[model samples]
Target: MKKRDILFFSAAFVLALLFGCGNGSSQHSFALGDSTFMLDNKPYQIISGEIHYPRVPREAWRARMKMAKAMGLNTIGTYVFWNLHEPEKGKFDFSGNNDIAAFVKIAKEEGLWVILRPSPYVCAEWEFGGYPYWLQNEKGLEVRSREEKYLSEYKKYINEVGKQLAPLQVNHGGNIIMVQVENEYGSYGADKVYLEMNRKMFVDAGFDGLLYTCDPEKDIVKGHLAGLMPAINGQDNPAKVKQAVRNLNEGKGPFFIAEWYPAWFDWWGTPHHKVPASQYTGKLDTVLQAGISINMYMFHGGSTRGFMNGANFRDTIPFEPQISSYDYDAPLDEAGNATDKFMKFRAVIARHLPKGEKLPDVPAAKPSMALNAITFDKEIGIFDYVGPGKVNENPLTFEDMNQAYGYMIYQTKVTGGAKTELKINGLRDYGIVFIDGVRKGILDRRLGQESMMLKVPAGTHSLEIFVENMGRINFGPNLLKNKKGIVGEVTFGGKVLKSWTMFSLPFDKVETSKIKETKSAKQTPVLKLASFEVAKPLDTYLDFRKWGKGVVWVNGHNLGKYWSIGPQQTVYLPAEWLKKGKNEIVILELNKPEINQLSSLEQPILDQMSDNK
Candidate 1:
């Protein structure tokens, strides 16, 4: 063993004598005491790590929880994404990865306590911040506020969530001990009524365990409820953490660090965020020594998976969308493998374990394979399959047209005119401008471009703009303004363009298998196909360094979007999504990539920068 391991074992032996073994008797009872949480009437400290069920593959939930336990954590914390469960409003999906009950049961099976944050708004780096996209279509809906429509929808959603997970709470013969109310209301608004509404909603829906609220140190008093525990986020300094907790609980007991950031999340253009273990272990040691409960924000950050990864924007930071990977550079990496940080933290956690308790041996990393390069010479043009569209005086936003995600095409006839400036009032995210079927230029929302000069010959011509909904703004006051597609009118030569036909191409709805392969790629976007054979399938990372910007589908499973802009160069392709025989890979290449081939990598290249960036 290394010197660190020897030191950890010695410390563990000493602490074991001080703190007693496990939650004493198994007859479960958890409640908020004057200053500490009482489990079976005895003080209990929650040692938890965060992981989202939807983010990790359903196949790996048990493994991830087991790993959490081995890391010396006794509890698991997770956020239930609202948009994922009810993707289409009335429709609800609790099956597969969205199965909250099963996820909780698995945590119980792994001997881990649970904390649920099922929400109307989670503000996770997720699409629309966990609010269903369809909610925007509802008239007078204002989220994170007391707007009747929003609250009404919020009630229904949370109640449904209660039905799925409420029965699993500790009071109901399960391991779930605490449930959070409204993610971080203090940073958003100071509406005490709205905060109270969220509290009642959780209770009314059946979460009877200790209900707590979490916020940044500044917002603790403002964001927390009168009766519930006020847990602080981000602040790791032991003294400040205790002070903030005291300020909220009126100098009472049961202080918790709801979200301790060991590392940070990555954005599309930013460097992969990482925090050195040495940087935080000292503060962690102090906090643990003080007997304060802490939950690391992400013990394991699985892949963001689909187009569901979110973006960040404001009046200042125009557009900085998140990458597909939600690696977070955490103790458990994106691939669910333990890192050096994992061991260092595990050693620290071992020192704090209950008396006569020892951390489990770290789980072995899963197998991975590097495959031969794949060629996708066969192609089908995206423009070839422009479906029937809705015609209106002006273009309708994705929400207005009753469509949620993916691309939109707004086409209109532009009358011949002299050199004039063509402008779009609300050109959202990104767009590719085309006149008479030839690519004119690009209108990128990230670049803050809304207008481009247009000079046309003397004849009526088609003006089409292909708009891609990069992602919705997930954080800050600007979330309300995040409607995908063109929200306003398009104009030419100072005159409003008229009678536009807009098509909603969600891509998932598009029948790519039906489209026949073509010899020549079109001027517009192309759908490239790669069919390869695998003798034995294993977990792999699909290299997207050569591809420009597009979504990839492997054997009908959408692996999400990838941009040439750096920081993430590959997409994680788990073996579960692969087949033993021939497998198909479909890519909707927006901008033509220089390479029409794809490769499988044994290791992920998450930190590589795109030269273009």
Candidate 2:
């Protein structure tokens, strides 16, 4: 056996001595003490790395965990996105990539402990901040608050996730060591009662292990529960962060950094976020020397596939959707390969390991291939693939239409009022305005424009507005009111427009074969299809470098979107999603069919910031 294996077993043997082995008893517990967290009645410091399961392919979970372990991290931290598990109300899915229990089991098999932050309201740049869109449909339901309606639903989700994870706690002979309650609540609101309620709900649902609260340093005290262990996030000043945690923990000695950001996240049309290893290593070293535990926010950030990506906006910044890549400039790149940052971090971790201990070997890089351009042989117009929709008196929100994600079209007629200015109230993101089936103006929320002046001719004319969800706010005070599509009213020259025909284009799934074929040289949105053969399957990126703004699909799976004005020009196509012999691709070109062919690139172009950036 390896020396490291021997050392690990020795520690386990000691734990077994203190607490009985095999289906451990209550005595074999992980508890929170004033000064330290006790495991098997001994102080233990958790060294963890965060990785979201849905963002990663199920086949790669073990490999990623192995990478985390190889980096000397003893624990794995992850948030359970509620929207993914329970896409609709009372409908829960825990199979495949949504399998929380299986993920925890894999972590245990890898000899790593787990820290579950099943926030349910996890603001991880995920659509709707992990809240189900159905929640918005609840007549008076206020999320992240003391609202009974919201709490009841929150309870159901918490119970479901808990049932899958609680039995796997270390006390029950499993690896889960900690459970965080209501992530960064204080940053959104200061509700002590709400935080306590979340804690109670977690306990009622069966999570009896080390329960805690994690928030930024500014919101730590406000979000913290009186008896719960309070952890700080994001701050780099070790002394100040330690002091803050100590103060919150009642002069405690054990300090924890719940989220140590090695790098920041990127928004669409913005430059990729990066930080030199030198920027964080010195601070990391200081924390380790001080004996403080930490969980690297994203040891590896994978792709935010499909429509799961989120958006963000502040006073200065407008509504900006995050690119599909959740790379975060992490030590491990989006494809799960190590970068220079990885080597630098590994060296730092090795130097900090307990005396005579060693980290496992880093895994090898995954294979990638570059193929020649894929010429689309078949094409169809957007109208050829229109699904069934409803007609409302006025334009309704996506949630109002029972739609979760994707685009929606609102068409109305301009009759009496020859309005100069047209306004769409509560326009979530981007909208393309047209009159008489001709494109006139584009109202992009990112540019802080929601209204446009229409040069309408006399008599009744067709008024069409095609709006993209862009993405719902995944963080901040907007989390509660994040209803996509036009929320309230549509006005023309201060006149409330009535009687509308709306179409739901909630591209949940597209059937390429079912779509009718049509060819037209006229400028309009088109769907293009192509096929290619590969002898062996290897990971490759679908190059949309030549294509305009639109979504891509491979073998009936949505690969997410790409835009001409982009920092992301390619969509990652995992080998698991590829076929051994023949592979197929379908692109739903949104604006213009500039090209009839698409190419595959050996690498991704995720840092080419757009013009408006």
Judging by TM-score against the true structure, name the best candidate.
1
Q: Estimate each model's TM-score.
A: 0.94, 0.93
lDDT against the true structure, per candidate, is 0.84, 0.83
Worst 10 residues of 1 by lDDT: 17-26
lDDT of 1 at 315: 79
Q: How far out, in Å, is residue 608 in model 2? A: 0.4
Which parts of model 2 are misplaced by more than 4 Å? Answer: 1-28, 33-35, 415-419
